[model samples]
Target chain A: MTSPAITVDRLTKRFGAVTAVDDLSFTVAPGRVTGFLGPNGSGKTTTLRMLLGLMQPTSGQAIVGERAYRDIRRPAQLVGAALEASSFHPGRTGLGHLRTLAPQVGVKDARCHEVLELVGLSGAKKRRVGGYSMGMRQRLGLATALLGDPSIIILDEPANGLDPQGIAWLRGLLRALAADGRTVLVSSHVLAEVQQSVDDVVVIGGGRLIHASTLLEFEELASRDVVVRTTDYQAVETLVRERGWSFDAQLDHHVVHDVAAAEIGAALFAAGLEVHQLADHGADLEAVFLRLTESSDAPTTQFTGSASAAPAAPPAPAAPPVDGTVAPPPPPAPPTTGGVA
Target chain B: MIAALVAEYRKFFSTRLWWILAIVMVAYLAFIAGVFGFSLTVDTGADAQASNFLSPKEIAQSIYALTSPIGYVFPLIIGSLAVTSEFRHKTVTGSLLVEPRRSMLVVAKLVSSIPMGLAYGVLATVTVVAAGAPVLELVGDGAFLGDGDVIETLVLSVVVMALWTMMGVAFGTVLTNQVAAIVVVLAFTQLIEPIARVALGAFDATSEVSKYLPGAAADALLGSSFFSSFGGEGGGTDLLPQWGGAIVMVTYILVLAVVGRLTTFRRDIG
Candidate 1:
């Protein structure tokens, strides 16, 4: 159990009458790319700002390494953060912007150029930031964060405004950073945006911790629903009910929950039900993320065995059922879950 | 501290505003000085009337010290924009990320403004001299650049510019909004303070207080100004002695800086 690189313990921040971050707590382990996942306006940015000491927390602690971010003597060399893409001065050239930060970060001008090239901004290094496209700005931001070559890197929405190819490039860069044993925490409002790069996830919604676990564990949370198109909807519904599987009945199809397509097909065949079409509709992680975040009433749960560190349960009464069939109550409208290839 | 200062200097120089403002300051001071040099030296057949009030040497001294009365606003604006521009463009976020100690950041901004103010001061002084010297030598008493009082006034003009620049930084720290700071600075320096000083000085009771106003104190610090000499005899207001003016300016800067640190500077940056 190596010491966590970042520890957020019961951190809370309130902006006057509104609480931006509730008593949220999570940790990112070293040597992995952890996705700080949340929907927009869910206190993700607030939490990250608190972690970086840019904003003071109302209560609790956001600790990095052995001390608070401000307490660190040379924080830039230890923790590199690019919290937003718009923080750059529009009139400054990309290299000039990094050069301004270089002396303060205790990095040389040569290191600034290195990070520029690392982020593939060498060609545009001399261009003013105002003229750079949004994607280019994000890359320059990544370049700024990498200037100090810190062991810990935190970026908020690094994929925003990026083309697919650029996002792919970012994904590779994040993975390579993690492979170098750096604790990389990249945040996004969408799960699929960071799905392939993240090894662990710390999810928050409504400013409260919703789930925290390895990517595999989070992926498993996506309820696999089997949609069976059958000639007799009534019989298919009856078969699903007899099997004790929850399902939503559509006009000509029955979307079965918690049962695999293979098992449902076998059950229907044994019953001599004419199944015109039986397909597995695997819910992508993004849909699961939307479900969890969209339903703010979803119970706050931690799956990393550190639930004891989390504050008392939120007001939500229904805990995820022990069977893990459905984490939250089914949405008001059944989600048309599709596989994310 | 060194890194913070270096960062601040870099931030100041990396923008176009500094040079643009410097150019404007040069042009502005040169124009004002030229006007004063011409108006004072030009024999309008009212020479008898003007000489009875101010000596040729005094008129020459007034032109040299014109840097404070007319050109101080540039350093103030430059100083202020140093802090306010960060807030305007949201670059303060990056600044704080590099140096999280907010007080240190503010102090760096204050210290960094000195060189900038001095540069503007030198430029303003040079412009005034260039524009005023030829006219004064040709028409009025010789360009009294070598006079003890004129040299002191010239040097103090530069110092006064630096001080005003620091004041601008403090003012910007308090306001934090770039437009509001600039508007307040322009209004107070160009309109509000001057008018208020004249109005306040019309009364015997308020005349002493008027001398301590920022503009008055700056004039007193320089030891001479066209406005101060214009109303020297009949004008009831008397600016504080040079030392008194220095104290007043320093007090204003310190108080503003402290107040800014306690209020806006301490607030969490979003």
Candidate 2:
């Protein structure tokens, strides 16, 4: 069966006086990967934990399909999640961990092998989890999460510890899983990885929802990205930062976003620097996310999109400061499309 | 609930902790029972003779008794770890994820713990007998295993040990922290309860209460205990009947589970 939509309705969670999640709500649609994006300490994990019923919301509800998670009948058969990659018991073998979860979801023990192979851990199935690397443990965690073949899969930082090739593989895998009509919500602080994978995004900061939008809106914002390579790389970087526009550093030079390419060329030519590779590689979700999260020029608010309506972009950089500090963003998008290098 | 139970059982097999501790328990108890048996038979020096735990004849009747109580510690650790390990390893997230209903999860752990405890109890029971019987034959005057009472005592000892295990799991479920649960289990089962029984028995008024303690009840249910022999102001004649003690032990397990279901187990897992 395909996954049903996940809806969060004014979910508020307070640990003592500190609210980890404040009156937040959003919908995660089936047949697409929804990126649960936030900076560190943004309450992403806390919210996910609440959704899975690992933690209780101080008020309100997170619903899976028609009912709350706790009220969901045969929940194991409907939802699967890996809230953290380190959830596997250290002494258990990879296969053993899945076996432990299989019967709970009413899946057969043989499914253990099926998932072990699916996650590429069949060879190391017998090896104790303690000996596995971070990447291997992540795979085992994924294996366990998928043990039941649930319709909705939630993974927090699923690409963490994976090498670049593995990250690429994960990108395809998540898309593939979503293509199968399952609801997949993947949480990550690193925007670069998630942007390529997710179809929709729900961003939160300071325990409140900042924006809910599709990936293309973010990509459209990113398409305005301009890269500049000059003799004096440092000079262009300082110029971009001084203008208050975000920039990401790279091996050759830097990629600057939000500002026009004409503005960048004008600044560099006026500075009398040798320009080599000033190109438009388009902005990614990373650029859009920083604009939405980092700029704390206003108080926070949430915007959820309709089924057919486009996502309303929040103020660039943030509804509020992610940490009340507009730290620098990640390096500019890799020159993947047309490059002038 | 049954699915939860099956998951809990699978969890026991998945982790190496259970079986590793089980083997360690069996080996240690077997070695100790054999040593106790050999030492009791010969007229050792004053210190060794003073340490003589049971007569060879007593050893034959309670062949499973000597090291059986010590082996209770393993099952207690197992039962407690069953709950605490989930938190320690962060598998509690996965567990609750797989089974969202906390009450059913608690029930499953409770139901599954009995059989797991029995698994530990059975291994220890078998080891106690396997290691003790031959030593009893070499040292005791009577033929070992001659009476039906020996088998009954062995069976009761295993049952009581299993009960202790379930109790440990209850403590674990309620405590939530692994180290805290271990400390309490050891301190209470190994020291506090035993010492409390002896300390409280000093007062006639409190002596009646001591008999109702888990340790005292366990002794009563098993029909014999080393501590109960100190009958004056330091021991109890006030303990309930064997069946009553069993009921009291079950009550303790039930109270912990019900209280946990109401509080700790229902709290946020992460």
Candidate 3:
């Protein structure tokens, strides 16, 4: 099978008044594993569905190998996808399920056993899917996706029901698929779930593109912030604003970005303020993801400018943390993402 | 196209539903045929009405044709399930992934349901003959299996079964919800249509229209029915000729299949 790049060119899907996918654009190049990351209800599945031609885009297009999915001569052989693990007839055995698909995929019955073995489901090939555990069903779903040995593999939340070992196995398998020059797009709400497998990340929130870049570039957006709590809140807030450090002032504490915990502690000590707590709250990928998606509207331009310059961009002071520790200001500019075409 | 057809057949045989429904259909047809054969042939001293209205041969032919009138529901259900089960289970995603052409998938489903319908037809016919012939031979005239009209009705019964199954597939394609499709099939075939046909046939004006109903068309296609043998021309409506019945059933299948293809079949699988 030929490896094909998937391109979503301003694809938009509006369900009545609500837009599920709002002019989202991203190109998934071949020979790399790309993570389609977003929180739940962020239109990740809608984008994938449009890409697979399982859904209609309101406007624009999703092109696979330069053609719409419906126009592909043999789509399964070109793009193997498993959108849901539960998309199986419970009465059918794993092998039976594969056999039903094998003929349409233009593969021999022997290929069914081969995929079952590939997904580590050979032993339970004869057992009905109704009796299979969620993890086993996930394996079967992976097996189904691998049936045609397609070069472009799209799996939506494949690791949702897997155990640690299964997740490890999936990571290895995804890496191996990309190593063979396939374009693998695996989507998940949690960035860490696919952190080890994906080479690039395309993040979306509220049906709009928030960030798209290499994983290394995305990780570089994780800034080191210092959370400082003190009795002299007025003085600390004045110092933070005076130093031009981006910060979010909570009711009892302040999260100061682009500054070390030691620096904040020294500043507090010099002011003779009673420092109750000072800790380095190193912003990890999860935190960066939350920051970007939580204030998705504000960061749309901030992150999309360039990953390297993302840190230097002014942080939205009003963009509150998602932990619900503070009442966030009302978000502004709902549909002003730069990717709108 | 051939690959899609093979895939559809593989889908059908992979489930236990076909055989389970087959068993239910066999028992139903056999019990109904046996009971009817016994009651119609038995010498009730009240009146010689059974013998005077129709010959033992005509009665025997009617019993053989019972395969279509009473047993068509099984093939109908099988056809409906063939389409509805895929949607119910969301396997249409996998199906479209392989074929990608929605129209081709619908065509494959329509074509594949034919052999399934034929298989059900043969099974239902065999059950009727196996259970009904013995009762007919013992108390009434000899089992007229070789008679031309009986043989014709049996063959037509098989064709009728195949048509009914195709109709089921078409109907299921239009009404994709599994519960709704099955309920509609059972209620229309078992309750609504029968009652409607009788109610309509009770009048001279509507009796002609009642013969055009699906069940009546199927019975008309088979060229005989025990219900018609007793009530012919007096209380019951006259069925269309065999060719006319075939045309009517084929029209139902074609119309339903077309509507389903243009509407639900073309809609996004999600």
Candidate 4:
């Protein structure tokens, strides 16, 4: 990859009375796909425009590698971008459009054909873009960005109009590009597709960053919890209350968090209560994303991106090992950076 | 800036718009030349106002009028459409993305207009030769073809047409709205400016400043026009000399281009 990272530091953009992006900071690390996720009108497009130098930021800057975007010589070659699907003239063919931009980055004519082939638009190279479907226009946008063989690719809603098969193709293409050690940042409002396509995610809402962390870490935070069953649930609840641990008391079992299952079991057995079942509960990314974004108006809602436990804060400290007894519970899963607020 | 220039050329030529407009322009110029030639060829009565004493000079001067009305407007459209179409089509987004520097892109667009003007100039020149020469011959103005003054008039028209095209580019850049720019250009050059010239000639007060108007200055550079005779003598007499008129046309381009560049920075193309 030509650049090691793209750092958007303290970026803010305001249009008259409305603030589009507000003091947002994030790093798109090289050799991985970082999904830029936000609800509609959350300033995702505005932030990308600033990164591409298409708009002036109200404050701060976006830097690719070592230099600011404007300072980079041959930016088209070093950092490829498709800011919008309909940015090309309709009368021009897909090939014609790419050919027009190919020279700006010193790309040869034949390479324009090569990019057309790469994006699967070789057959429609001579056809006017007005005749192409939205899916085809997206492909053409990709081809134009790829014409320079740029090491950094920034795509905005690349999968908006793609068919199921096309999305799968894009999934593979993005993986391949990232695997080639290039920095890839793709933005999308469609959270499901991003969850599948990206290795890392930067979630924003209401013009502020909600979270920035590895996808695996995000999913782990969303899913980390336990369910326990006991003959005397009253006794277990009594112990949980005494220890000030977190748990949801259900009709049969208790959904517990912030304390390990073994600790719950130890506390229960110490009270002479018999433990029948204990299991971890799993929550998907969709549930976590919904809970975080939907709580925009209701600050009282418990589920929040900012309220998420930080990675450095241990949810439960491990208890000392007992002699010739059940081992002390392993610490609750280590919190990775990000979540709620 | 050079890369942006290349990209602009590619943008114009890569589409069917340039070639399509060019073909139509060529046909229109040919038709105009044919009509003008045919008119000179067959007029049973040469002059109705005066006795039948139409000179070769009058006919030659009549041909020069086509240089302003027919020639200036077409090249102006070419320049205006090339810049304005980008806004209409929302293709300005891509142009800015590649270059990023607004001034560089604006300057390149203005520079590209020169070649467009040159192309139209050559076509109009060829039309004058193919159609005007033979007709002028039939009218016993064969000497008009070889006349240094006539040749200089044609050359000046070509140069002036290029300047007008640059003005069209400036207008398009400043107004980004395609229909608005076209309307403003047509009204100012054809309707407003010409009508104002007529009003100036009628009244004694505004006649001096009317000669400085863009269309009048362009006419002044052409040296002779049917309007010079039809509109009366004082209108032509008060107009700037050929060189001064050319300067006025260039000033219009500079003013509009600077305005466009300033506003472009503030425009957030979403």
Candidate 5:
């Protein structure tokens, strides 16, 4: 495989007694969007800051290209970053801010205009950044990051404060950037957003990496709990009770245990039961995320986009099961670091 | 270095603060020169005003001399503003991230300050010259300062302003808050240095130490002729001799700038 565009090696950072990033390690390759997923204050920001060399890592190192970020002779052209949308001189126009950063990255001034247009900020380029709404600021921030045509882009919650259209625009932009063979590492708590945009996932909790893999792989690993919903809910639930199957109840529907769809279909036919739905329900990123990060006292989860990387546990065992039914044992998947997969 | 320098200049000029501050400096200089011009003209009268035989340089010098006291403040603002503004806006993080080799940026900031400081000095110098023209014409060419003196003064003014700008940079690095930097710079200029110098002067044993004080050093660089009366032995009042002041000031700037840049590398920007 080609060298990862970004490689963070056992990085650690501390602010006084609080350890922000603890021995975190990951690699983001080119041609893909790697979702750096974590909850708030979970060391995601600190790790990103260290990756860009905005903050000194207490130990370890972050490499962009072949060198550490601090050692890169022309960093802007190598790795473009947008950490905070509000980090700008309020009195300066958006165009002015871009112009200043463009030359530093060795890009032509025209690139600024091009990027402004790319991020849909062309019409507002002349406006002072202070006057911009958060959504507009985020777009402008993205434009700045793209100005240099960097080989790698690192954005911390770049989609924050964006409307649906803005988020969609950002998702498409990231995809296009990755298509051009650039590495895009975006950190956010929104799994759904990452679900829609990212190609790979790097999941972390409590300042530790949980797992890293392709998007589909992370989904399978993180959401192993099979959800089954049927209109003949009472009959199915009663059947589950008779068999001592444990499951969560739903409004207007019944969610049974990990019973395989094929087995359920045959049993329902044999019992002369008609069902509206018997499809196997896969876990959404939200459920997997909450399940993976549920230590009660765990740091507040900031959902940039919903994407998970660890295999989830089955529902509680106390509920009754239905006749001729057994939850399919987890999906046949690769070994997970922290969960049974 | 060129890329970083260009970036520094771009960031410096793109902000509204620089323009507004420039306007304020121009207005203040014009007002001061106007007052000096009128005074010199009224003293010399209309006959001298018509002959226009006066030396333009001396009139320019005296007008500039009166105006020079105010000159330091603006360049100080420029220096502090250049560095402190980045902290104020939190763009320092973005700037450093783009070029993590921060020492080069500090150097670029110092290099860029020269041209900017020169520009402000030229504006103030030209305003004094332009305003002093009528006064020179009125005072007779004899009262007009020679070109040698004018050139020397202008060059000295530029260098002095540049040094102060660098000093302000050091100050800004030492104190990231713009208001606090301004306050400390102002306090040093108005109170701290003066008090320190005065207190130091009272004791003959430590009087020599006062010459190296920041205020005295800056005063020497401006080629102020009045330093001898400030208690130092005639030649000692100047922290450095004619050309030595620039070298000394540059050294101070280099040392402080390096310290500032090193400090920045170790900072964990939030």
Candidate 6:
């Protein structure tokens, strides 16, 4: 019943003849982190800009906390953002920049150092921003975004250049922010990072919304196939075909299509084929992404995690297990699983 | 709006480029005074009786005139930097995100430039005037505070220069490129305006039209002193009356400012 933290309704933007964002509509709720995922040149940043009132939409409205960004009387105290974390004066020290922005945002002077410490940049607070590394700049940016103590935080590519430690730190920070019942909208091209950090996901491609769903629903809808591996793989394929079940043939396994793993196992056992390994491909979001983005010219055959469209790298090995502790099995199948043939 | 103005002020002062420009203006003033001091020493032979050559009021007026061209550069640079830094740093996205009413932001910037411009204008004038005091003492002529007109002229000149600086901000916003804006202003102020003004004097209609030029408004600040040496109503009439110059300057500022605001408010920050 509560109003969404961010509402973008029927938003559109045109640059000359090209429509960058076309009738895009979505809402991000409070108390959760929403990931805004899209490919490059897909108008994600443009949409964010419109939402923040940095650029007026051609037609439609964007509201943050029930009011337009322009109408927010004390904006910084209501919504904090880091659009470009590095857009700071090179000569100004990190703390000095915060101090300079403090009076304008109407926050207490002490919050400057408070946010600095919160972002783990307290050590580099006195250093000029020019000398800080990219990771340090990202932390400083997070500090600025948190300085106002606002209920809403928006960041674009917040993890673009972070090291693994920085990324882990950022993941924890976002989790903590959402835990405090605040709204967080983060945009990134990396689906894996978003999968790890956000509760909800809104996928956009070519400036249009592809899907908006909870992470569980997205994974359920996207993870569609099960791979069955057995020493009698040939017999299993024959049984699947004889039963009119369609599946992809692989080196040592069969990716049974449409039918469930239990159904496949029942059919295989009925055919007198002993199954050694049987499991669904463990939560590969890329398959769903490929199906969603699939078209005649679109490259869907190379679907894999992180390196989907990388031409020279071959296919991505596979998605890591969802628990984050285990790596996905190696490629060229071990003659017991159903995947590559 | 006030918050934005304050923020713009902070952005302006926080730059090392601004500090460097300030030093340049102050140093230029002192350097000119030093050169003038050298000239007086050579011309007056250091005798107390011939000290009239170093009259402080005359020297003050002369320094005010001689360095007038150089004094205008700071405000121009300040105005350009105020807008261009946003583009150069890509902070326009962050700033516009905070203050969505971008026209108000442009207005804030225009308002903010006034103080810094005033500081430069006042300081530049004061430095030249104050430094002239001792040099004039070396000449036999006594120092004259003169009437309130001197103070008024100095104050008005500073105010006019501040407006000039805001005009530069509008220029920066329209161009959105720091270097291009600065170059255009410098070229027009230093070279083109002077040439155009002289060429206009050859014909009465063009001469009258030239009064509306930005340079004409700048020259108007000095009042009758610009025509002091000539006879018959100082031998030259203003292109426009003094008030007309103010009107012309304000008009230039408003047109460019409105265009600048509209452009900035509508354009995508990225």
The best candidate in terms of TM-score: 1
Highest lDDT scorer? 3
What DockQ does candidate 4 score?
0.55
lDDT of 5 by residue, A1-341 (tens): 23257888888887888867767777887778999887777788889888877788889898888888888777787788899988999989999998888777888888999988988888999999999999999988888888777788999999899999988888998888888888899989878877788998887766666557788877664333344556577787777677676667778666555566677677767767777776676546676565555421132322222233222322213322212323223223422122211
Better of 1 and 3 by lDDT: 3
| Candidate 6: residue A71 Cα off by (Å) | 2.1
Better of 1 and 2 by TM-score: 1
Residues A1-341 of candidate 4: C-alpha lDDT, one tens digit per residue: 44578999889999998878877888998989999987788789999988888788999899987777767777878888887788878899888888788767778899989988999999999999999999999899888778778889999999999999899989999999998888899999887776777999887765667667888877765745678898888878888889897789999999887466677667777888788887765545776676555543233333333333343211212322223313333344532122243
How many clashes in candidate 3? Answer: 0
TM-score per prediction, in order, is: 0.89, 0.83, 0.87, 0.83, 0.83, 0.80
DockQ comparisons of all candidates to the true complex: 0.72, 0.68, 0.78, 0.55, 0.67, 0.46
Order the candidates by DockQ, highest first: 3, 1, 2, 5, 4, 6
Per-residue accuracy of model 4 over B130-244 as CA lDDT, tens digit each: 6666776776456376678777877877777778778888878888888988888777767887778777855678777777788778877787654564444454446688888
What is the C-alpha lDDT profile of model 2 across B1-270, one tens digit per residue? 777877888788877677678778878998987876666555667745423555555646544565444666777778888889988998888888777777777778877888777777778878887887777676655535656777777788778878888887787878888998889877887788777888887778798898888877877788766464323345555677989889998999889878877888777877
**Which lDDT tens digits does candidate 6 get at residues A1-341?**
23248998878889889878767778898989999987777788899888887777999899999888889976877888887767887887898788767766787668988999898888888888999888888888888888788899999889988998889888999999999888999998778776788998877665666567788767765445788888876778778778897789999878876567788778777778878888865567866655444321132333233222211111213422223223244443421111111
lDDT of 6 by residue, B122-156 (tens): 87777766665566555423324363655666777
Error of 2 at A316 (Å): 16
After superposition, candidate 6 runs with Cα above 4 Å error: A1-3, A224-281, A294-341, B33-59, B139-149, B224-240
Chain B TM-score, candidates in order: 0.96, 0.89, 0.96, 0.87, 0.78, 0.82
- Model 6 clashing residue pairs (backbone): A250-A341, A251-A341, A253-A338, B51-B139, B51-B140, B52-B140
